[model samples]
Target: MTETVKEYLRIDGTEDDKLLGFLIDSAKEYLTGAGVKGTDSKRYELAVIMLVTHWYENREAVGKVLGKVQLGLQSIILQLKAEGLKSE
Candidate 1:
């Protein structure tokens, strides 16, 4: 997944790559910890929803970061799907 993410970021040439990496790391850490207790699921969901809403509403720096990350993720998924199909 990290390799896929890096590949995606490499295409963008955006300076926010480091910040995006940090956010992805933090989200993974939080999700791991949350999964241990079996609580915090709603909190995590709410946090994501709020963050997305804030990005859409602002349409500024944060929104740009979000857009790039989304595009990267989409590319990664598409690549993975293609690879899976090739294997089959």
Candidate 2:
């Protein structure tokens, strides 16, 4: 597992290592649960990590990021569908 999200969150110390790891794992779990598979998994994982980390740092900007993240997710979904992954 990479620490890109932790670095993005500016958590260079070990004090919040567990929390940061949990957040990354949770992001991966949530994306997997959403049916994000194959090559798209890595792309969505990074997006989710950035989205979650950004949201955690700036809750007030949730509304703004939400649209962008949703658009990204939609693009991922479209790609998946085009690659023959069923919606249901």
Candidate 3:
């Protein structure tokens, strides 16, 4: 998952591996708390990767919002939640 996120972010170093891993876990927890247990593998993985990218790029507490990331994350979360409901 770290590798996937790193590739997605075009990161070429291992120094941030630990931070990336932590972000992945945090993303999973956030999804779970938002009712997106992510039964769909691709969606789940993508969500995690997307979140890690967002967090990695915006480590500072105060920063301008990146275009599409905020909207895309919300959209993916909604999709995951809807799928979870359907499966249930």
Measured against the true structure, the TM-scores of the candidates, in listed sequence, are 0.31, 0.59, 0.83
Residue 45 lDDT in model 1?
37
Q: Enumerate clash totals for all models, in the order shown.
A: 0, 0, 0
Per-residue lDDT of candidate 3, residues 3-88 (tens digit) = 88888998898898998888888888878887887564797888788777777888983122356876887888898788778877
How much does each candidate deviate from the true structure in C-alpha RMSD?
A: 12.1, 4.2, 2.6
lDDT for predicted candidate 2 compared with the true structure: 0.62
Alpha-carbon local distance difference test for all models:
0.44, 0.62, 0.78
Per-residue lDDT over 22-54 for candidate 1, one digit per residue giving the tens place of the 0 to 100 score: 554554454344332212344333333333333
The TM-score of predicted model 1 comes to 0.31
Segments of candidate 1 deviating more than 4 angstroms: 1-11, 36-88
Q: Whose lDDT is greatest here?
A: 3
Give me the displacement of residue 67 in model 1, in angstroms: 18
How do the candidates rank by TM-score, highest first? 3, 2, 1
- Candidate 1: which pairs clash? none
Model 3: CA > 4 A from native: 62-67
- lDDT comparing candidate 3 with the true structure: 0.78
Weakest ten-residue segment in model 3 by summed lDDT: 61-70
